[model samples]
Target: MRVPLALLMIATPLAAAKRPTVAQLQIQVKKLTEERDSLKQRLAATDSLQQDLVAAQQARDQAKADADAARKEVEQLKANLKANASGGDTLLKDLEAARKEAEASREELAKVKAENAELRQQVAAAPREGDLVMLTRDVQPARPLNLNRATPHIKASGFFASRPTGVVVVNVLVSEKGEVLDARLLQGLPGDSPDAKAANEACVQSAKNLVFDPATSKDGNTRFKVWQGVGFYLD
Candidate 1:
């Protein structure tokens, strides 16, 4: 009862799968068509995206131009501000200079006023012209009046022309060099007549011609100023 190997092999069936039905094949075809339509929709969206990118680039260029213009405007404003500041500083300096000048002018005016007051005081304290004020006793020369070398110079012709009959005294201020610097009439005639005035002027003139010795201090050595009197008795 042993069978042949070839006949046993033929009796064993192969493990092959069954074939697909027609309806299943139709469902697969439908899915592949839907995928193709979705791919077409995505490809159409790429053109719109490209247009948006172009618009964005144009907007970016316009924004850059606006920013440049704004920057230039800001720079101009800064320059203007700096110029105004310079002008303000110059104005302040000018004001300060004017104030200093005013102060100087005020000081000068004060000095002028002080000088005027001093001059007025000096004028009040000075002696008047033709005053016969004698030197103080302490400062007078040793011989205040020296009649020697004075009588020879007197003449009758000086007062005789006026026909005056009075004594005329003249105050002569003698320098240390025995020179007569000034002569003033101390005593004249009793009346103020024309002849009396003439006689007084003649006496003053004659007194100036008189010579004298050098004046000395109380110690009789130091040269000093002195005053002398010359009398003219006219008849």
Candidate 2:
């Protein structure tokens, strides 16, 4: 009932080959899993770097404010020293301490500046670094949208400058300080001409750099997620 020797020899190699395929497939699966884990780690690292960069910017700003305050204190101390000329020794000691405080603050400010520059470079060098801007439509400000204080420099080049009766609508996230955090092109021109595209880009830029009154409420608890339309009309 068994196979002959010649047939058995031939079938043996086929079975061996089949066995190796499963092992090879297992190896491939393991390799793929490792790659996936590596990618996940990289993505997590990128997010961490982005957060650090934001924190560094905030620290740098605070350092600058501290330096300014220290300078003002030194100036006031000097004035007090002059006014209290009779108590010269006491005022001189106070002035000296104020100068030292100012110097320390300046040094701290310089250190923060260098750290911020380094962090910025790191963030820029990241291959998969993404924008921190988040555009959301679920925003209701306490006050109504006021374009009276919103003045966008909507000067389009190439097509829009010479053309007339065209409008570009942009959705923007405005901060409590009246700064445009980010913008997206909600509506562009009808056609896809080079000029049209350029105009649309211009509209986005203007929206990003737009100057407007703070859309925040009296308690400053408002988000200015609003649509802004820039238009060109014939004279």
Candidate 3:
């Protein structure tokens, strides 16, 4: 009986060790549930972090695109400015050329006016047909008269003396006796002003007083008409 009792005691202890208590089983189940919840929260945090990374990458790309656009715009503006500068320079050169052309035209106009005046003078001095003879120092006359002797007869008014040097052309008719038949003013100063009229009358009167040799034609006719120029000089 004692031996069976000892064996029974050993068997009882072994059974208690093999089977778990109710309270210890509940603690293990609670621990396993808490571990599962912690793992779920970590997965959620990883997903949110991935989404944030994607958003950051998109923003960076957008900023890069905007910067590139700005740089391109700046380059375009620079090109436009350079083109405008070149155009401005060309316009300035064209203006300078135009000014030079205008100056040359003015000079040419002045030259033409001078040439026209000289031509007028030459036309006035030219000889016409039907003249008896051209009176020169070389031609000997029947009775020579000094033209300088008539200088005292020339009358100068205050108005005529105030003007610049001028000229008067006269036509003179002489008789066979070397007497002046008529004297007329061919051309005088340009205007018909009082000064011009006085100058013309005074020159005509002086020319009428002038004594000259009888000018003859080739046939020795003792009548002639002569055109002469007289200059009025200011002292």
Candidate 4:
């Protein structure tokens, strides 16, 4: 009986030592749950960060496209401005050529009027049938006797002062005594302005002051008409 009781006591202590407590098991389970929750939260945060990165990249690409479109618009405007400038230059050249042509036409018209007046004077000066007795005598042609003396009067006139350079046509009738009987302006410069009229009148006055050599024809008749063109120039 004493030996059996000692073995029973040793068996009882060994069984109690090997058995685990409920508090220790509960603590281990709580620690494992916390570790799983932490891992899940980390994965969720990483997904959100990736989504934000994608959105930013898309915005950047759109901005680049907008910038390219704006640059193209600016280039087109510059090309249009250059084309307009070139067209304006062409228009200016056309205007200058037109002005030169108009000036040439005015000069030509003045020359024609003067030539017509000169021809009329020649026809009137020809001998008539009633003057046959005067035509029978030997005569000399009419010629200027004081052209150098008359030129100074024309230069000092109001007509020459207005148009310093141009042509004036005058018709003069001279008597047998070498005296000017009549003088008139045939044609003058291009315009009929006040200055041109004054010039014409001045030319007529100058012609009246002229003296000529006796114009004796086959008949010694010195009465004749003459057409003259005088040019004025500024030195």
Candidate No. with top TM-score: 1
Looking at candidate 2, the ten consecutive residues that score lowest on lDDT are: 1-10
- Candidate 3 TM-score to native: 0.32
Better of 3 and 4 by TM-score: 4
Tens-place lDDT digits, model 3, residues 129-167: 333333434323323265544432233355435442344
Which numbered prediction scores highest in lDDT against the true structure? 2
Q: What's the distance in Å from true for residue 2, model 4? A: 99
lDDT of 1 by residue, 1-235 (tens): 1111111001223334585533333334334433442344334434554565555455545545554554555455456656787676654555455455545545554554565565456435533333322243333332323343233222234444435554556656777666788887766668877756766776677677766664554455555545544455553
**Tens-digit lDDT track of model 2 for 88-163:** 7887787778778778777877887898788778656522212222222222221224433333333334443454
What TM-score would every model get versus the actual structure? 0.36, 0.34, 0.32, 0.33
Q: In model 4, how large is the Cα lDDT of residue 27?
A: 37
Candidate 2 lDDT at 54 equals 79
lDDT of 4 by residue, 15-76 (tens): 34556533333334334433442344245434554565555455545545544554454455
Instruction: After superposing candidate 1 on the true structure, give the runs of residues whose Cα lies further than 4 Å from its correct spot.
Output: 1-134, 142-163, 190-194, 226-235
> Candidate 4: deviation at residue 155, Å?
8.7
What local distance difference test score does each model get?
0.49, 0.51, 0.47, 0.46
RMSD in Å for model 2 = 23.0
**Number of clashes found in candidate 4:** 6
Say which prediction, candidate 3 or candidate 4, comes out ahead on lDDT: 3
